[model samples]
Target: MSLADSPIRHPDTASRPLMTRRGWWLVGMNILIPGSAQVLAGDRRLGRFGLGATLVLWVVLVAAIVTWFAAPTVIYTIASNSVALWVVALGLVFYGVLWLVLTLDTLRLVRLVRTQPSARVPIAALTVLVLVVASGGAAYGAYLATTASGFLSSVFAAGPSEPPVDGRYNILLLGADTGPDREGTRPDSMTVASIDAETGQAVLIGLPRNLEDIHFPSDSPMAAAYPNGYGTEQGCLVDVCLLNSIYTEVEQVTPELYPDAAARNSTPGIEAMRDAASGVTGLTIQYFVLIDMQGFEALIDALGGVEITVEERLPIGGDENLQNVDGWVEAGTQRMNGYTALWYARSRYSATDYDRMQRQRVLQEAILRQFTPANVLTKFQAVAEAGAETVRTDIPQSMLGYFVDLAGKTRQLPIQSVELTPETGIEPAYPDWDAVHALIQDAIATATAEPTPAESAAG
Candidate 1:
């Protein structure tokens, strides 16, 4: 057969060459349909495969977009599942590499050098752009998914789902303090967030670090050691036991008490605190989120920093007395870095623990508000990495979908708090157990109950 009637396809034969417009159209087809260029003029086998993959991807994309608008929670549920995420990552990898190969083949068919020399540069540049966006973008996405999977695995344990109690999920939040200055890791900041299972309204119940004579659950391992409470008969100045010390005290004194905790990917110290928190609040703590206070600094830094109103001057670094202050975070509304924010939440120099606790709450609220979706999307990797290193929780990773949904709701509701301090008739040295339970219950009831006209108008 003559060249004009040749059965085999070749690159426009060197003699015929290609016009700039012809080459541009070929590249455009590949960019638009991924494999159309090949199917139209090149390899049908490879083109078919690429076309098939592209069709599936387009369908999935359209379905996902529709599902997001129709029922967003379903999307969230799927994204939270580790297995689903892995599948997504793998799919992106396979398709990304495949599309990249197809694009390069499309470029070869275009025969850039055969076109106007001027068009070759622009065409090559455009092809390079597509490769980066299609392949490089996919790689970045896979990295994020893998990062999330690792974070969930490291921070959240795999366990049976913990059901809420009394229409609420009481979560124990602890700021674990560990360093060379401290003997062992201590849950310095203890608060129980009692959340309405449906409404998502939350009531924060703060327990003072110095809370003494804290009674353990009747059946708790620590209960036998001190039947009356977790303290000595004589109290302070003798052999005193404070609430914050319970964690380290248990680990050091009775590490064997919770042997099963390790198997469940939990520590004895956390189990002990969960029991104590339950006993103290008279509410079952279904889950516990333990965050190392040191790592908390990094979390704040990841958000670029946080702004808090300081009504008083707070000392930075100091000793036992906190007298030799290295510097002071001057009074006024200020944006602080990790180190400064940490001190703002912990300064106990000339201030009482009550003041410090209040400051901690202030900082917590400020930081929590900073986690807007846009902000998180920008800084998620840093935040997730920091959390994996510093945060520990008993809540199963399987339940992440539910909790993530719950968190979205909670963010919309106003927060109420009850602090166990002198102002609330709670004495660190000797708190009235009956009164403490009553206050916590009342707080929860108020938080979950619908506000009346008069109560609503009080604003």
Candidate 2:
């Protein structure tokens, strides 16, 4: 027999099976189950490893969810820990690499099975597309987490402070205005947000900016400097003893008056204000968040502006001394941009600070209502950037996770407020501290109590 006719055969080609619909099935399975493709392709060892990784990933996700609900503080502590954040970031990167590798491996197996080039090309393209999308999503998620961690570190303090006292955390919220004309940042708006730790109910106690003779805690440095309370005796101008001026005063004299305060709080001015607020309200100030009024407009704009009801016309721009107005915000229910909202909260042309305070409260509530999860997801980067620029606080980063949870709860609850205005029988110049304390206590009690049937129905 002739040699060519006797044994014309290709052993490798004969043994390999032709690619069919099963090849596509394997690719789909690999995407869904991560390792089943390898198992069916006869690589049992690799398949087991891949499947194990998938199982571990699911386990971690479940554990995280359970911890979020069962022990949120733990999650917060971990998030605040730099080491933990780094580890998580690296883990995400590793997972992304693994996902890409598995995807490529699946495509390789599909190509290994003999198939028409046309069919193989489409399958490979689809596999690569899935890999790119999945890996990109993981990388993006990691980036966001890392960015948040850095932002938290920048804005929050290092160590955790004392927890809520008697089931409530009393935080001083200060709106600090820093301008070239002003000597330093002054807390133009001051409010104490007393929050219930368990239920997230909150009572905002608004202090008139012109509140005078504000006292400091007996043991506080401010108290040591001004034994007779922050008043005219301290060489404050006629209205310099006002609550709003405390921040500027303390900041200017911190080095000489309260050298030790700088060690505890990043902003000594806010610390002084906190002590003053605590002394007057008879409540412990656990933490203070100072919002830079310069960034106020940006933050409002980031939230797509806020809807507010203007009882009367509001001036857009003006100088207190000049009594000049640049523009006016028409009255009625209307949507306001950042500039209009800032003026709505700060304007004092024909309106008194008392009126501004009411407007400020309404604006604050409106911002809270508008900052829903949907809004945040839609404009996450903008909101994050604006928040980082606008907010400064002595609250520890480790405790932010707890506060995040609390804020979500707070958004669902009705906010109660008590204003120290003339109608409330509290004069800014000679406020009755005793009465003020009583009012705050009463508001907290009423707010923390379970809502009445009528109130619940209305809510």
Candidate 3:
């Protein structure tokens, strides 16, 4: 029969309403199906081709599903079978694209129906292609969600453990800018995070980066190392002795190359600083997290900016020593991104590192306030991803889940921040190990004694 001479059966010609209804019903299904609509519209060739395409699409979909489940072993060649997280993100994108294509195909089919004698083959082929893509995308999206859940479960497996100290735990959170970029390598900022797991009370202690005469846990044989001192005054002397020696030694060793080696270099320099701080604080360091400035900035931005009080008026571009990256910022109760916030917290140009340390303490408090439900809801994924990239710690991967849970529960609590600097106490010319030990002992004792509920509220 000639294509023009072919009979076109209208649904109105059917004797029973059910029979006529079958055509419209088939058309509706065909809108999203491969070739069903074409068959109802009297296109046999299209119906046959559509069925074949449907079968092929289903087969491919099943194969993809199987591959998705086997992702952990396949993608990483790891022994354990695990789903890949990135696969999930890709699946979401695919689903969105597929949905758009399917929607367009439906519109095309509707347009074809407007023709006097619907040419079903063309529309049917298009519908089949759309269905195949959409169905595949949907299947992939489901697979990705499953895989991503598994990946997240693996990511936050670590939890906070009981510190050696009876009830209170000391966490050393260090922000170091000493990675690939070499942006800045000032251990200029440090936080001694003390959490009373029992009482749910927390205290963050900040220390000035340039507090002269602080103790150092040195491996240098030239410096006189004092392990223990007799009294608080003697302890101060020991710390003084150590810092003076470190400054002298760093100056002596390749003076031009190792000018700031006592503080800048990550290996022995940073490590020894940690040890010295630990010795002085008397807080058994339970956990330590070190992050570079890039990661630090990313985290602040992800958290949607932290809230800080304007302690003193800060004008931009005053200090030549800070170089160009810093000193170009005004200070106030301002919302700061990671970079700007870092500058604010690490600004040591105008005043001593002591002033910067106070800023750091205030910023930490600001962070606790900013990391609210509203903040997390708005930027949870961003913050999480940024944190994963920035932070380096000794905490095991397995306990991250516990830490996350702890963080969530205590995120809203008011942060009590304090800075131990020369302004608060005396700085000896030589290392006074005994005095430093006493200071740490008093702080820990005060922190551990469970405060009255009213006292907690007052603080």
Model 1 lDDT on a 0 to 1 scale: 0.80
Q: Is 2 or 3 the stronger prediction by lDDT?
A: 2
How many pairs collide in each candidate, listed in order?
0, 0, 30
Ranking by TM-score: 1, 2, 3
In angstroms, give how far residue 333 of model 2 lies from its true place: 4.3
TM-score winner among the candidates? 1
lDDT of 1 by residue, 207-322 (tens): 89888888878888878777788776644222347887778766777778888888667788888888889888899888888888899889888878988889988778876676
lDDT of 3 by residue, 213-253 (tens): 45333442222343332122344322333332332233333
Worst 10 residues of 2 by lDDT: 6-15
**Candidate 2 lDDT by residue in tens digits, 1-459:** 552232111113332234646557777888898877776664668888888988899899899999987987677667666667777888888788878878888887765447565676777778888898878878876786687667666777887567789899999888887755766677888889999998788888888888887887888887877788677474663335678777777676554555666566566677778888998889999988888887988888888988998998877777765356788989999988888998889888777778889988998888877776567657766767988889888887667767877777788888998999898999878878899999889999988786744568999
Candidate 3 lDDT score at position 379: 62
Give candidate 3's error at residue 434 in angstroms: 4.9
Model 2 scores a TM of 0.87
**C-alpha local distance difference test of each model:** 0.80, 0.78, 0.53
TM-score of every model? 0.90, 0.87, 0.55
